[model samples]
Target chain A: MKTLDCLGRRCPVPVIELAKALPNLEVGDLIEVLSDDPASANDIPAWCRMRGQGFEGGSAPSYLVRRLS
Target chain B: MSYGQSVPPTTNLDSASGLPLHPAAREALLTAVDEGWADPSRLYASARRARQLLDGSRAAVASVLGARPEEITFTSSGTSALYEGVRGLASARARVGRHVVHSAVEHSAVLHAVASLDTSVVGVQRSGAVVASEFAAAVREDTAFGCLLAASHEVGTLQPVADVAERVGSVPLLVDACQLVGRAAVPAGWSVLAASARKWGGPTGVGVLAVRTGVRFAPGWPEDEHQHGRWPGPPPLPLLLASAVALEAAVMESAQEDVRLRGLVDRIRAAVATIPDVEVVGDPVSRLPHLVTFSCLYVDGESLVRALDAEGFEVSSGSSCTSSSLEPSHVLVAMGVLSHGNIRVSLSRTTTADDVDRFLGVLPGIVADLRAQAGV
Candidate 1:
C-alpha cells in the first residue's frame, strides 16, 4: 500500500502525481490518492480509464486505485 | 477598427467564445445608431420609420434562418433566448408533467434552465456525441419538454438532433443552435430554437429565439407588448439590426466558409495528434468546421492557455482551473474523458492558412516544455 497526498494542489497536479507515482508500483499494488481539488474527484477515475489502470471506488479528496497495466 | 493595442495583430483562435463582428454587421451597426434611434413601438412619424426598419430586420433574420418573420424574437443574449425557450415550452406543457429530457453534453444554459424541473440527462460517448438510443429511451409520458443542442458549444461534436427529434415523438424539443447557426445546416424538426448572434460574427448582447407558428408555448415572462409579447421593454434596435444583417450575411457565405474552415480544422486536428501525450477530444468528422479541442497530460489548462496567449495566440480552456467556479466543465465530465490541460482553438472567418501554420509550428514545443517543467 502507498499513499499520495495532493491535498493543496489543483487538478492535473493531483492526477499528474498519481500518474508519476503509478509507474514505480508493481501490478496489483494499491495507491491511495488524497486530492482536494474538485476536478480531481472525477479526473483521477477518468485518468485511470484513459490510462488503462484499475480504479477501485473511493470518494472526493480520497480515491483508492490499484495498478493494472 | 484598431483599439490601439501595442501588438501588431494577435491571432484569435477563440472564436467559439465569439467571433469578431462580421464586416456587414459593423456597417449595419454604425448606420443603425443614427437611423434607428427612435422608439419603434410608437405611432409617431419617426417611430413609424424605426418600426419599418425593425420589421425589415426581423424579416431579414427570418429569411436567413428559414423561419417566418412573426416567429422570430430577439432577446438580450443567447442565454436569455435559451431561458425564454425553455421556460415557455415547459410552461405550456405543465399539464403534461414536470419531467424534462436533455443531453448531458448540452450547454450549461440548458442545464441551468431545467435545474428545478424533473430532468433526465442522456449521457454522451467518448467523442462527445450523445447516444441516440439512450436519449430516445429517456423520453417518457410525463416529459414536458426535451432539450438538445444542434451541436456542442464546447467540443463542437454535432448531435443527432434529427434522430432524437424523431424518437422523442409528441414531446416538444427545444434546440439550442448557439454553436452551429450560420456555420452549418440546421437540423429540422425543432418546435423551438435559440441561438446567439455573436456566434456568427454579430455583436454581443443579441440573441435569437424562433418558436414555430403552431408550437404551444406559454410566455414565461411578465405580460409585455415588446418582442412579440415574449419579453418586456423596448428592444435594442441598433444591435438587433446589426445581428440580423450579420446572420444573413454569414448564412449566405456559410457553405463556402464551411469547406475552407473544415480543411483548416482538419490540419489542426492532424497536427495536434502528433504532440506527445495529447488526446484530441471531440468527434473528428462530425464536428464544427472551425473548432478543435485537445488535452495534454501532466499540464495545467490555465497555464497552457497563458502560454498560448503569450505566443500571440488567444485560446480558451474547459478545465476546472480555467473557470472561476472551480468546477470542472460538465461537458468534459459527462464525456468521461481526461480534463487535464485542455485547449480549445476555434478559427474565425478571417483566419488564414498562414495563421494555422504558425500555430502548428509552436504547439509541440510548448506542450513538451510544460511537461518537462512538471517533471512528468
Candidate 2:
C-alpha cells in the first residue's frame, strides 16, 4: 500500500501523484489520495478508468483506489 | 433568422452546451418533442395540457432560482430575458431615478441594455472583482436600479452581491445567474434574477427571469395577460420541461459533480502555472468549480481556440469571434491582463476525469505548437 498526499493541489497534480505512485508498486496495490479541490472527486475516478484501474468510492476529504495490471 | 446547424469534426469542450447530454437529456428530448409540442398559450384542452407542462416547468425553474413560480417568466433566450428585464426595470424605476449601475464584467446582454440606458458601470480590481465599496461610492441618491452577475461568464470570477447590496442601501439588485445557478448556491439578497437554461445542460431557447415579490416591473410591450404582461412571447413547453429537468438533475448531482470539476480545474491550474509567461485569470478560491481561464502572452486567442478545436477539444475563447475585428475581450482588458491566447475550459456533470486528462495531455502540445508557429 502506497499513500500519496494530493491535498490542496489542483488539476494534473493529483494525476501526476497517482502516476508516480503506480510505477513503484506491484499489481493490485491500494493507493489513497486526499484532495481539497472539488473537481478531483470526478477527475480521479476518470483517471483510474483511463489507466485501466479500479476506483472504490470514498467519503469526502479522501479517495481510495487500487492499481490493476 | 435561421440558426445554422454545422457539426465540427472534433471533440467539443464547450461548457456552454455541457458534455453532450449523457443519455438523460438526449433521451428526454426525443420523447419530450412528441409529448410536449402543443401550444401552451391557447384555450383548448390540449392547450391546457401544454399549459400544465409549462406550469410544472415554471415551478421547477423557480425552485432552483430561489423565487416563486408567479415571479418567473420564460423567454426565448437569456439575452431576450435580460433585455426585457432591463427594459422593464428602466420603465418601472424611472420615476424613482433614471440611472442604472452595473458591474464592468457583465455579459454583452447586460452591457448592451445598459448602453441604451442612463447607466454607469463600476470597474474591478486586478483580481476581476467589482468592489462593493467602489460600486456603492459611485451610486448617487438618485440611482434607481442595478444589475450584476453572480459569476462572470468569461473569467469565472464571482461578485460580492450581498455586500454590494448592503452598500447600495435601498436599490434593487438584478442578478445574472447564468453561470452560477446550477453550479453553486446563490446568496440571498437579489431582487431580480435571470439565467439561460443552456448554461446548465438544458436546451437552448429557454431562459428564466425571477422578479422578487416587492420589486416593480413594467412590461415594455403592450401585452395581454401572460406572465403578468411582463414578457410578451409564447413559451416553448418542451424546452421549458427540458430546462426544468436539467436544473433539477444538476441540483441533485451538484454536490458530487462540483467537487469533481474543482479537482480537475485545480490540476490544470497547477500544470499551467509551472509554464512561465502563462497568466491564469480569475480568483483561485472564490470562483466557479468547473471553470478556469488562462491567457498566454504573445499569442492570438482565436488561433489557440481553433488549434485546440482542431485537436478534438471544444473550448471557448475570450477573443472576439466576429470577423475582421481585432478587439480583445472586455473582461480580460478590464482586469488589465493579457488578452491573446486565452482559453476558458468549463466542465459539466457528464465530464469525467478522463476528459480532463485527455484535455491536459493534449493542451500542452497545442500551446507549444501555437507558440512555435507564432515564433514566441
Candidate 3:
C-alpha cells in the first residue's frame, strides 16, 4: 500500500495528483490518500466512481482507493 | 424602437455584465435630472411637483413588476435591496423561527444575508438547477425565510420558484429576481422580490424591492419613514424614473429578444458540444434564453476568458483554481460539474447574432490552444 499525502491541498489538485499517481501502481495495488480538504471526502469517491476504480471507504482524512483496471 | 435595430453593434462585444444603459433610458435619465431635482418628501410647490413625478415613476415600475406602488421600494443597489429584504423578512418572522433555507446556487447577496443566520443550504442537480423535492425537504418547520433565485446569474438555469414556493407553504419566499425581472415575467406567489436597475439597461445606483401585500416585514434599522420604512434615505428621483422607463422598455423588448437570443445560445451550445472534452452545463430547454455555460477539461478558466477577450469577445469565468480566489463556484460545486475551466456567456438585449458568431468562430481554437499549452 502506498500512501499519497494530500494534506493541506485543495480540490482538483489532490484529485489530479491521485490520478497521476494511480498509473504508476499495478492492478490490485492499494493506495491511501491523506487529505484535509473537505471536498476530497466527496470528490475522491466521485473520481473513483467515474474512473471505474474501487473506493474503499475511509476514516476521517484518509481515503483508501484500489486500482481495479 | 427595438434595441437591435436602433443601436449599431460595437467593435468590442461585451456579454459579461448587463450594465449598458439603453438609449431611451439615458434620455429619460437626462429629462428626469432636469425636471425632478427636488426633495419629494417636503410639502412646498417644487416638492409637490417632485412628489408627483416620483409617484408616477413608482407606479410605472409597479405596473411592470405586477406589484402595487406601495409594495415597491427603490434602494441604492440590488445587493442592498437583497440585504434589506432578507434581513427584514427574517426579523419579521423571528417569532416563528430563525432558520433560513436557500439553494446553494443563490446569488452572493442572498448567501451573505443568510450567512449570520442558521442556514440550511439545499443542493442542486447536475444541470445547475435546484430539485424541487430536495429544496422542499430542506425546509424545516423552523425555517423562517426561504430564498430562491428566479434564475441563476452564472449558469442561467431557471429555478422552480413556483414549485418550491408551493412546497414550502407559509414560509416567506424571497425571490431574487435580479436576473429574471426584465428578461421574463416575475412568477407569482413569492412573498418578497428584489431586482436591480442596471441589469435591465437602467442606470446604476437603483434597485427595487417588492414585498407582497400581507407579508410581514420589519425594517433592518430605525430610520425616518421613507419608502414605507423599507429604505430609510431619500431616494434618487432621476435614477428611479430612469429605472421605471428602462424596465418598461426591457420588458416590452424581452419577448422578441428572447427568441433571437435563444437561437444564438442554441448555436453556441451545439457548436461547443462538438469540441472535445467540453461539457456544457445548465438545462438546455429550461434555461435563460441568452445565457450558456460550459467547462473545458484541463484548461485554465482565466486563460480562456482572457484569450476570448483578446479576440474581442468578453466573457466571464467561475473556475475555482484559475484565480486568486481558490473557492470554487458554489453553484458548480453543488451541481457536481467540472469546477475548473468554466466560462459563462450572458447576453444582453443589444447582443447580435454576428457577435455570437464571432465568439463561436474563435472559441474552439482558443480552447485547443489553452489545452495544448497546458499539455492536457
Candidate 4:
C-alpha cells in the first residue's frame, strides 16, 4: 500500500497529488490518501469514477483507492 | 417570447461593482463643479455658498438614511468609511475590550479591520446567511464591537442584522450597507452603517458613514473640524451633492425595480439549477432581489467569466481560485459550497428582461462546451 498525505490542501491540489501518486503504483496495488479538504470527500470518488478506478471508502478525512487498470 | 425570437439588449449586467451614472447625478455634479469650488470652512461669500450646499447635501443624505445629519460623515471611499467606523468604534470602547466579533462572510474591508483586533468569526450557514445564534454566541462581554453586513455583496444573502443586534444586547454592531442601501429599505437596530455611493447610480469617491446617537466613537486619526472632526480635511461638495441626489433617486426607484428584478433573479435561480453539476448558492427565497450566484463543477471561474464576456455579457466571479487569486472565495468556503467556476450576476435598475433571457439562453451551451473541452 502506498500512502499519500494531502492534509490541509484544497481540491484540485489533493486530486492532482493523488493522480501523480497513482502512476507510480502497479495494477492491483492500493493507495491510501489522507486529505482534509471538504471537497475531497466527493471529489476523490468522482475522480475514481471518471478515471475508471476502484474507490474503497475510508474513514473521515482518509480515502482508499485501488489500481484497477 | 423565447430568447431566439428577439435580439438581446445591448446593456451589460455587472452592477454589483457599481451602477451606471444617473443623468440627474451627472447634471448635479457638473453644476456643483462650477459652483462648489470654494472652501466651505472659510467665511467668504463663495465659501458660505459652498458651505450651504455641503450642509444641504448632508441633510439630504441623512433624511434618506433615517439618520441625523450630525451622525453622518463622508469619506474618500466605502473601504475608508468601513475602516473609520470599525477602528473608531473599537478604539472608543477599548476599555470595554479589544475583541471584535463578525461573521465569516464579511467584506474584505471589514475582515481587514477585524484582523488588526482580537477577532471572533462566526460561521455562516450553507444559504450564505450568518447563523444568528452562532453570531450571538460569539459576542462576548469583552467584545468591543460587532460587525454584520446588511446583505452579502458576493452572494446577495440578507443577514439577520436585527436579530443579531438584539442578541448582542448593548454591543455596537456596524452594518456594511454597500449592497443594501438604495436597493432595500435600511434595516433598523445597527449602531453604525456604511455604504458606497457608486453602488447606487452615484459617482465613485464618496462613502457615507453614520454613527447612531449614543454610540461611543473616537476618530481613528487626528483630523480637522470637518464632519464633526470624524473625517478630516475639506469635503468633496460636488460629489457629496451628486451622491445624495443619486441615492434619493435610487431609493424612489427601488420599490418598483425590486419587483421586476426579483422576478428576473428567480428566473435565473431556477434556470441555473437545471444545468449539470451546477449549484446555485445563497438563500433561494431570502436573498437580495437582483443578485444570484452559481458555481459549476469541473470548470475554472475566470475562464467562464471570460467566455461570457466574449459573448457580450458582463459578470463577476467570486471563486478565489481564479488565476489572479490562489485562495478560494472565503464566503464559499465558509458556506461549504463549491468555490470553482462561480459567477455572480447582479442586475442594475437598467437590466432588461431581454438581457436576462439572452444570458440564460447562451449559458447552457457555453457550460456544455467548456465541460466537453475540459473532458469533465
Give the per-residue lDDT of model 1 (tens digit) for B1-376: 7786686358999999988899999999999898899998788998987898799988988886678999999998899999999899888999999999999988888888999999998889989988878998998889998999989878999999888889887888899999888889888878899989999989999889999998889976677777757877888888988998898888888889999999999999899888876888999999889889988888899989998888899999999889988888888888877787998999888999999999999899889989999988
Ranking by lDDT: 1, 4, 3, 2
Evaluate fnat for each of the predicted models and list the values in order: 0.74, 0.00, 0.00, 0.00
lDDT of each: 0.88, 0.77, 0.83, 0.86
The DockQ-derived docking category for candidate 1 is medium
Model 3, range B229-280, lDDT digits (tens) per residue?
6887789998988888898898889889889889988998999999986788
Task: State the fnat of model 2.
Answer: 0.00
Tens-digit per-residue lDDT, B1-376, candidate 2: 5468564446555685444443455566676688777777778887787788888889988887778899899887788888888877888888888888898889889988878677888998767899899988878777778888889888788899889988887788888888887789986788888888888888888788788888888876668666667767566667778888888888888999888888988998998876656778899988888888987654556777777777678888775432245455778767766555678888776667787778888777777876666444
| Model 2 misplaced regions, further than 4 Å | A1-69, B1-9, B17-22, B37-48, B320-324
Best-fitting candidate, scored by TM-score: 1
Predicted model with the maximum DockQ: 1
What is the interface RMSD, in angstroms, for predicted model 4?
5.2
What's the TM-score of each model vs. the native?
0.94, 0.78, 0.88, 0.86
Each candidate's chain A: what TM-score? 0.95, 0.88, 0.95, 0.94
lDDT of 2: 0.77
Model 1 residue runs over 4 Å out of place are B1-8, B41-48
Clashing pairs in 1: none
For this target, which candidate reaches the highest lDDT against the unseen true structure? Answer: 1
Better of 1 and 4 by DockQ: 1
